[model samples]
Target chain A: MKRLTGFWAFTLLLVLLPIVFPDNYYVTVVGGTALMNAILAVGLNLLMGYAGQISLGHAAFFGIGAYASAILTTRYGWNPWPAMSAGLALTGVLAFLVARPILRLKGHYLAMATLGLGIIVHIILVQTEGLTGGPDGLSDIPGLAIFGWAVDSDLRWYIVMAVTLLLVLWLALNIIASRSGRALRALHGSEIAAEMMGIDTTATKTGVFVIAALSASLAGSLFAHQQSFISPDSFSFFFSIELVTMVVLGGMASTFGAIFGAVVLTFLPELLVVFEDYEVMIFGAILMLMMIFLPQGLFVSGQQLLRRLLARRATGTAKEGSHGAA
Target chain B: MNIRKTLSALAMGTLLGLGALHQALAAEPIKIGSFLAVTGPASFLGDPELKTLQMYVDEINGKGGVDGRQIELVHYDTGGSPKKAVNFVKRLIQKDKVDVIVGGSTSGSTLAVMPLVAKARIPFISLAGSVKIVVPPQKWTFKMPHTDAMAAAKIFGDMKKRGITKVALISGSGGFGKSGRAQSLKLAPQYGIEIVADESYGKKDTDMTAQLAKIRDSGAQAILNFGFGTGPAIVTKNVRQLGIDLPLYQSHGVASKKFIELAGDAAEGVRLPAAALLVADQLPDSDPQKPVLLAYKNKFEAKYGPVSTFGGHAYDGLFIALEAIDRANSTDKEKVRDEIEKTKGFIGTGGIYNMSPQDHLGLDLSAFKMLEIRNGDWTIVE
Candidate 1:
């Protein structure tokens, strides 16, 4: 009951803050983009946070989603909604096919293999100029429409993205409280132990991998629709780094942390205009400071402090009771 | 304890609020935005353009600025990514509210911003070379360098004049390179020339010996290398290493001194169409562009240390934009664009710019001077 109330409260806060937002530009530019990134981060968190698998090439999946939706709607004259669905399905299948061979590798080796895959995809997009429009990228993608209502404004896009984020977060939270989620968490703690307990480690990892890929794809599709453009350069190695940074900064094992990290980092660059030259340097410094000072993350640290205060108060009352009995 | 925490929070909030207010109230300078590949693989092109832009902006500000408003240039490193270009342009138009935009190093980056500029109705001048930029006319976009079509015509016309009939072509699969190859192929027959051999490589490819060998063995009279950024240099080096001694015909993009330095001895005797500023010393006093060329060349060398064809494009683009603004007597975008379209015989660093509504490209064949690299220096070939 407590958890449900907390979830509802958080969802309400997310919906209400934009209403009180200072300006439309901020909501659309900073808030909308951050929300979109939050969706991606949350999806990635399910794999990295809950399942304890690392992926450095998730942006390739993101690109695939963007390109798929872009090509479908622009070239074939399909509706935007169907294009997004097709994009997600395509990414899911591709992830499933690659996950078997990829799941065989572990640690940094797995990371490099995924990186190679991303590079190949990038190269192909650049080389096939006739099909992909080469490096100029596919432009003028159509916006999303539902029940004859078109979302043209940034505020409307934000509402749509925020609703999608809530759905994804609810599903993720449910998974975290489920039996399979426990099995995945067990594998993260000890792979051998998880296998010994008949948890089927490989299957769980692959399943989670595909889910993460789908999440990335959905986010990418949303981005394409919102920006009305897609390009291969958008999903380069730098984007991969950024996604991972958001995941790590928000505490790897915390669902809420992912959203928090995405929001903060997304707005960090905009707020740090005076440090334009030192943007990357300041980013590095903040990461280091967080790792040393907060360690678990801002959310985790706050929770820990609250727990400590509550425990101290309870112990003080017990000690007073013992003194009164004496 | 709760009061103390609230006070601290309030103090922090007040400080942040004050900072925001200060930034908001800061003098509204004439904001000029730039989209450049400042941190990616294409930084070599963008870094120099950025430096030259800064030098020009500083020079103007030092001279009391235009109409007493100091220029504030807000640059975003697109990292050679078109998506980032889109995002940065959105921020520039919707957030920063810049007056004008300048300096895109790549055709992709420039084209990405065209829609936004058209929507916002602001002047955007690109330093990229694609003819597609101004085509299908976005009401606000303009390019400084000669387009691929014009350059193609110039190269083939020069080839015909030089009595070169059979030429081999080699390019990469990039947009610039592909466009160069396509335009050259389309214009080849018009010049009474046949493409004896055609080959291509990827952008990240280092070894072009296989492709060059194939071209060499095809018995072509000359090699028409149509690519930019180190690819031309690589082709030149490989041609020499493979011992293909035919005269080389390059695109205008290879007019950079960096290409010569990269290609070493192989770059010598390679002829290409170049702007007058590149070979100013070769122009006689009787030449129509002699004065403008000499003045720009001296100023560029003194200000930016050395001059390249790319920097010359910046100088020309900026001068043309400023001239159009002056003619219009207001910073209104449509007025400036109209004035730019009606430009006639405006003495520019790149010959005389004569723009019309039908032809956004201001310069004609006469804008390019046929020059060859002899002993690491440009010399007039015709």
Candidate 2:
């Protein structure tokens, strides 16, 4: 009930934002990008925060998703829907194949393995000029359209992205509250304890890993269609690091936390444009201050503050009522 | 009756004056949007370009503005990321409602935003190096720099004259290098030159002795580098260190004083094709590009240190856009785009542009002056 309430509130904000500020740059243009980042971060949080795994190369899956859709649609003349499906299947299978071996590695080894995977994918995108169009990238990619409506304008794209983000969030929330969610929590606590509790640790890790990669793939496909262009530059090692930052900064194990972090990171640099030459420096300092002040995470600490205020008000009213009765 | 008549006349005159003032206020400044990779791996290309645009936009405004309307520059630092470029471009088109756009600092960023700019129907003058931006010309897009293909042709033309039949290729793995290599390969056979060996180094790689050694063994008479920044400088130094005396040719990517400064003494006798901006002082007064080149060079160096052709590209793009806006006599998007397409004999820092419906770039091989580094300064080579 508590989680659902917060989730609905987040959805409400997404819904009401465009109405309140029609065609707002931050809410619509940058907001669509924020939603994409939030999707990737949410699934990643499920893996890293709950299953206690790290993927330093998450952007590779993202690139795979983006490139797969891009090449299939642009070269093979496939419909966007089918092309997106192929990307999902390809990423899912690849994730499953790599998961067994990669999941066997513990701690930093796992991180290294994922990082290697990411670099290899990026190199392939650049080196495979014939298919990927080299460093120049493929342009004039067809945008997504329904039978009647086209997802062409920023507002249309924003609505589509917001709905997709909501679906991902809902699915994530359900997963967190289910039996597997408990198993994930158990995994986070201790692998040995999780295994002792009759959880299939190998299968669990693989499932979560595959799920995380699929979300990135989904977002990647949408990103390609929205931009109508795909480039290897968009999916680099730094992007992977940025995803991890969103998850950690938002609060691990908190879905809404991931969204909060994604939005902040997306909006910060755009809003900091006023700083001109000092923009990057100030952005880093502000993020540093946030982490310092809100050690628990942005959403986690905010919730805590809200609860504290509510409890104080309740007690204060009760004390006044007692005085009146006496 | 005389007092009433005087009061009515005065009231009518005041209303007419207020209406004239309102009309004057309605003539808004021309907003020019720019996005550059001013603080990233491509900063060397974008920093000077941004400085050039800023210095000139302010100057143009101070000169009573273009067509009596002030030029408002809305610039963003993309950090060489295409994702940021796309968003900032959207902000430029939809939010800022810019009349025209004048910057894209890298091939990737330009290509990423090209389709969007086309859809927006705003005039976008690209400062990037890719020929794809203008080739088979999109209706509203124009470019400033000599395309990599043009550079290859100019170099190969010189190669053909020297009767150099075989050459080795060493390019950077970045966008510029890759595109240049492709163009060279595509045009090599036509120029009657055979590529004896081909090698590439990573963008961040500082050592190229190994690549040069392989080129030395290849029976090639000369070697050409199609990369920019420190990579080209490093290659030049490595070629000298290896004692391979074959003539070294570089692309216009290194048409800057910084390249010579970086390569130091090893840069001596190295030749490349560049804009007249590099050899501005050496050009004859009769040269069509002499005045524009010298003016841009003098003003840019006076304010922002040394000038590079990359900044010259921006200078050309801005003035060209302003020229179109002036010719059209309005900031109407379609009219300005048409006027820009019809640009002829426009003196710019890059070259004398002759834009047509067929050729959006408006530069020929004559615009590219082959230059050699002599005494750590650029000198025109015959």
Leading candidate by DockQ: 2
User: Residue-pair clashes per candidate, as listed?
Assistant: 0, 0
Q: What is the TM-score of chain B alone in each candidate?
A: 0.85, 0.90
Predicted structure 1: lDDT? 0.80
Taking the tens digit of each residue's C-alpha lDDT, what string does model 2 give over B154-198?
999999998999999999998889999999999999999999999
User: How far in Å is the alpha carbon of A129 misplaced in model 2?
Assistant: 0.8
**Runs off by more than 4 Å, candidate 2:** A1-3, A317-326, B1-26
Docking class of 1: medium
Each prediction's TM-score against the native? Answer: 0.90, 0.93
Model 1, span B300-365: residue lDDT tens: 778667766666666677767767766786667788778877888877776788877767667788
Interface RMSD of candidate 1, in Å, is 2.3
Q: Write the per-residue lDDT of candidate 1 for residues A1-326, one digit (tens) a residue.
A: 65456568878987787777745576666788888888889888888887888888889888888888888999899998889999999999999999989978888998898888788788777777766776777777888887877887667888888898888888887787788889989989989999999999989999888988998899888888887756677887788888888888887878888888888888776666557667667877887898799888766666676766776788865542222100
Candidate 1 TM-score, true structure as reference: 0.90
